[model samples]
Target: MHMISALLFGAPDAHGSRRRADLVQDLLWAHSDPEDAVQHIRVRPHPVGLEAVLLLGGRADGAATAVVALLGRSAAPLSRQGYTALPPGAPVQPPVPSGPGD
Candidate 1:
């Protein structure tokens, strides 16, 4: 079970992003392999639209295909602009530096 990551763009707003995430999860649950896809998801604000990070369970190509198909049928304004297979334990995002005041 390899780990795959993807970024989905084009969400109207924060609320819309949340809705999109929920819809994605539901769709994946219904459409994808029961135990080999869509492990986790996170949403963040972006200039064009909200960006979502999807952690999937499979090879890069397979994961991308599943996500693309799911997004195509989702009916939400979301598109997978980028995705990659991650090495085990690789950090999805860079670590944030703490301020001195903290």
Candidate 2:
């Protein structure tokens, strides 16, 4: 159960960037898996009106896949936040095996 967390900061354009980011964040949270995948996510406006913060937590691999899916479905370009890879400080959890215990 690898875990990853990311913080996406919006660009300088207040209206477009903030709106797009908010929409993306909402969609991401809506589609997130609270049990096996993303446990939680937080989105808020930044001090700079043009910027925002997106905090997300989920399985590392799953998070990566979700991010890709989100980007693929998005009308706006998420590249402005330099989202080429996962953010720092993401924790990886050990996998849980399934089996019948004696």
Candidate 3:
């Protein structure tokens, strides 16, 4: 499984509560594949903040890639808040590439 996080910006549109709900639904649909089985999807809203955390099992890379695509499509400015693996650790350093002198 993999987890993806994103921060949604901008104010609610007409219809108030319904607008926010529709936006959230659209975001989820945009980020998820109908065929794929999603393990968990969570949406949290604050007075001035909207956060979404998606837990996807199976081939999670697809879901992660979809999120990047959806963020690009969204009219509202969405920023990638942060990300972490299951162990909740920093990234590993790749082996240094050998120069001309080996």
TM per prediction: 0.45, 0.35, 0.45
1-101 per-residue lDDT for model 3 (tens digits): 88876555434343454445455755666655554455666666533345556666667657666555554554342323221111112233322446997
Q: Which order, best to worst by TM-score?
A: 3, 1, 2
On lDDT, the candidate that comes out on top is 3
Give, for candidate 1, the lowest lDDT window spanning 10 residues.
79-88
Instruction: Show where candidate 1 strays beyond 4 Å.
Output: 1-36, 76-102
lDDT of each: 0.49, 0.44, 0.50
Cα lDDT tens digits, model 2, 2-98, are 3344444433355566565565567556544444344444444443222222333554556566544543443244444432222334442222435
Reference-based TM-score, model 2 = 0.35
> Which sections of candidate 3 miss by over 4 Å?
12-23, 35-37, 46-48, 72-102
Span of 10 residues, lowest total lDDT, candidate 2: 47-56
